[model samples]
Target: MIDQLFLNNFKAFRSASIRLAPVTLLTGLNSSGKSTVLQSLALLRQSYDSGILMSIDGDTDSYGGFLLDGDLVELGTGQDLLHEDFASNPPGADPRISIAFTTTDKQQYGWTAQYVPEQDVLPLNLAIGPSDWRDAALFSRRFQYLQADRITPATTYPRSHHQAIGRGFLGARGEHAVNFLRHHAQDVVPEGHPLRHPEAGGHTLLDQVVAWMQELCPGVNLEASEIPGIDSVRLSFGFGGTAGLDSTRRRRPTNVGFGLTYALPIVVACLTAGPGSLILLENPEAHLHPRGQSRMASLIAAAASAGAQLIVETHSDHVLDGTRLAVKQGRLAAGDTAVHFFRGNGAGVEIITPTVAEDGSLSEWPEGFFDESENTLDQLLG
Candidate 1:
């Protein structure tokens, strides 16, 4: 579980450090830098996974080549990136990215990566041992970051990996969701019988997911199958109606509503992720109905209860309500969950942590924060 995250001069963040919980909910207005936090984590983990930064050997000059072009404009000099710019008085005037997290074994680790504006490079400053890098290596595999605009309905199959059958690895745009489900179906159910194993908790998890999805569109059933020519297994959803039982049985995954396709990856990822893994989700409530959004919150909370750490960036009250519901239902403790509200001020974006009480009440509610209906009503009544 990532216990903390620090950001400097990364995107909208000039300098910020956020303490993480088992389930961290990031909510704020548009352009408040919520996505930036997640993006930085993704880039850092990706670089580590691809050996992009491992080859740097602590040399700032060698790291300059890897900095994004835009980041160079923010950092005037390459060498200045090494020193923390605490004196910068302007908003969004920080020049470093620092993140601190703890592994499952209670090992504390910190990484500070900054962009050299003059030379366009990013150098990594780590606060943990070389062995910790192995766990960090799994960061790329464990952490899954997604954007809202990128999500789409399953209108077509992805052509990149033809051998893909079921859910694919934390799929891009959730295209590999079905493939991932089919491939990992055994993991979901030990005996390979998903329906019959009522005693198995894992089966119950998947069944609840399928049942919840069915509530959205009745008569839809999900089943896994292996095609003879395909190298991977596939998950197909059967629909029933006047279209005929045969037609419903023959429907491909592409025919389902966008919500299912868009949400399937999130559900599968949470269900499949191992204990101690960090799951960073950007806008998990995107394209989902209020009910579906709430359901997503439940799923995410459930994942955290099962041992995975979840960091979600969302604008939906339903999502917020879902987490609170989890707390109320005893699935999550108040201290185990946190709601961080990001507000842009003269000094970049300020993060406000809202404490969740034992009774599911927030300690503070900021202005223009999840009060959409109130704002609308005031305008109309006026």
Candidate 2:
């Protein structure tokens, strides 16, 4: 859904503009500024959702304060957090982030945020510009960003309040995963019904998700329940095998495998997102096996086809392959997906754009790019 993104004096990007498709895949080696692009989009969307942007107040004791500290520190030190080459201009130069995107209905929107360094504090300013075109009304929704190290596996469970689990948005680290489910239980199912009714699209969404997960790991069924004394909800899994079926459910999230917990939010987002929504995901393939990773890619493509605009930063070749497969299967059109690879050089990082042809083949592939695993294997073998 996003049409374009522009960055100036931000992180490793001195000045760069990238065109976006319905499903945009950002792949690069470590420190190639892939996460920076997602972070910028997250901040932009956050600003819009919150309706105001403030400077990094050093005294606040919240996550926003920490984010402010991190952003300013990154800017002040001019160090590439991911080990890439990131430099600040001579002096007195302001850093700015600008994003231009179009909604599903074809309305265009642009937002620019600028930060000016001061003696001991930095002043942040935000500006909302007119979209180049207009169609439908645009609403601000929460931006989702999943870092590589922060993924929570699905095998974990959370505390619950009742037998019924609700549905809500999953937190970044999946901390509120169970609570999210419990809160949105109504959306998960219709009133006075145990099985999903035909008219309830949300039920169908969950069913599709379960069906897909079964393809990855056979005999796995997911259900939600609320804890007796807690306000949170927990997830339980039923396994089928030769020995009678067994079920293992936990109230604490720490018990499950990291992959399931981490991938759940992605699945939920894909199933729940509506038109004009923007989802920014970093390393959606983290902790997933090759097959699971490929399946995840297909899920993302399906979400985009359903009208959500997704920007994914990944290092998994399976993810790329999945996208290509989606194109080949006619689930996604060639023009609907864009793949950008970032390569670092003395001048900074340059981006290579790969086009998906009608036959689902890439127009070109960059050298020494997106082969982190292969490069490591070669070094070890040699």
Candidate 3:
């Protein structure tokens, strides 16, 4: 697991070191540098996956450097990524962007990319870390990054053998989720795993997914199947909750309410998390009601307890409260969870971390940190 993330002259940060916990919750206002934290980590992973993040041979330009455009992230160019107000370098030295991280085992890995405004591939003049760093969670196959702009409810989803099967990846936008689910439905969840839904019908992955989805919409079960002679998969739903209703009738994703389909990737991602996993989530509470959002937080907590390191960027107060409830209930330790609120401070972004106590109470709640409901209530009473 990554212990800390350091960003120097990257995007909105001139120089910032963000602490990461087993389950880190990053809450903030719009453009307050919350996404930048997640993007930087994605950028590093994408660069390394493209064979451009580390130096194997003496030559650093061709074989290794930061690949700005790739499968993970598409940061346009050095100019777009570099911080605008970077501090001056030493005499005759050019400006550069650097990203580095220290793991829990005290292993430090860093990369420095030259600043060429027009070029996307920032050639590294200096790189540090051993090749064995691939063993780290960041480079591991268990890592999942679900961006905010995910796939909407549709008739059918794409089926990719290499990505969904070979790589075991639910696409960045979770576009391959249905296909991945169709393939892994029969796989049994590890015994005594936190992912096992007690109310689920069986120990299989699909059962747990349906059990969890039922939290959002009671008695809703889903199925994923391959389209005959096509590179697409179909996701259909069945309902058993309504009295006197026919549960056999199937419902397409377009018919099964947007919240469940929109939140499918998150459910699958959390259920798939295991030891040494690194899951990056963006607004996992996007399109759900208050209770459903809180239940999603419980699922996230369960994943962390199962030994995955999750860094979540969210805008939901219910998520925050639910995570605190997890801590209070001993599902997650107070020390193992970190909550950071990001806000602009006139000069640059400021990250404020509050303490979580044993009673699901926070040590501090900054003025703008989930205080909108209270503020509005005060106005109504006045």
Q: lDDT for every model?
A: 0.62, 0.59, 0.88
Instruction: Please give the clash total of every predicted structure, in order.
Output: 12, 26, 1
Candidate number achieving the greatest lDDT relative to the actual structure: 3
Number of clashes found in candidate 2? 26
Colliding residue pairs in candidate 3: 52-65
Pitting candidate 2 against candidate 3, the one with the higher lDDT is 3
lDDT of 2 by residue, 75-146 (tens): 332232212332344354544444455443454555444443332222244333343222221224333555
Off by over 4 Å in 1: 55-97, 102-106, 118-121, 125-130, 137-140, 155-168, 188-209, 215-218, 223-236, 240-254
Write one digit per residue (lDDT tens) for candidate 3, span 1-382. Answer: 8889999999989999989999999999999999999999998889878766766334545446788888778889999998998864774578878999998888888888889999889888777776677777888788899999888889999999998898888888999889999999988986789889888877889888988998888888888888999999999888883211235788888876678888999999899889899999999998899999999999999999899999999999999999999999999899888999999999998999998988888899898999999999999999
Highest TM-score scorer: 3
Which 10 successive residues of model 2 have the least lDDT summed? 63-72
In candidate 2, which residue ranges exceed 4 Å CA deviation? 49-51, 54-114, 118-126, 131-139, 151-168, 185-205, 241-256, 371-382
Ranking by TM-score: 3, 1, 2
Count of clashes in candidate 1: 12
lDDT of 2 at 124: 41
Q: After superposing candidate 3 on the true structure, give the runs of residues whose Cα lies further than 4 Å from its correct spot.
A: 56-63, 241-247
Structural similarity to truth (TM-score) of each candidate: 0.77, 0.74, 0.96
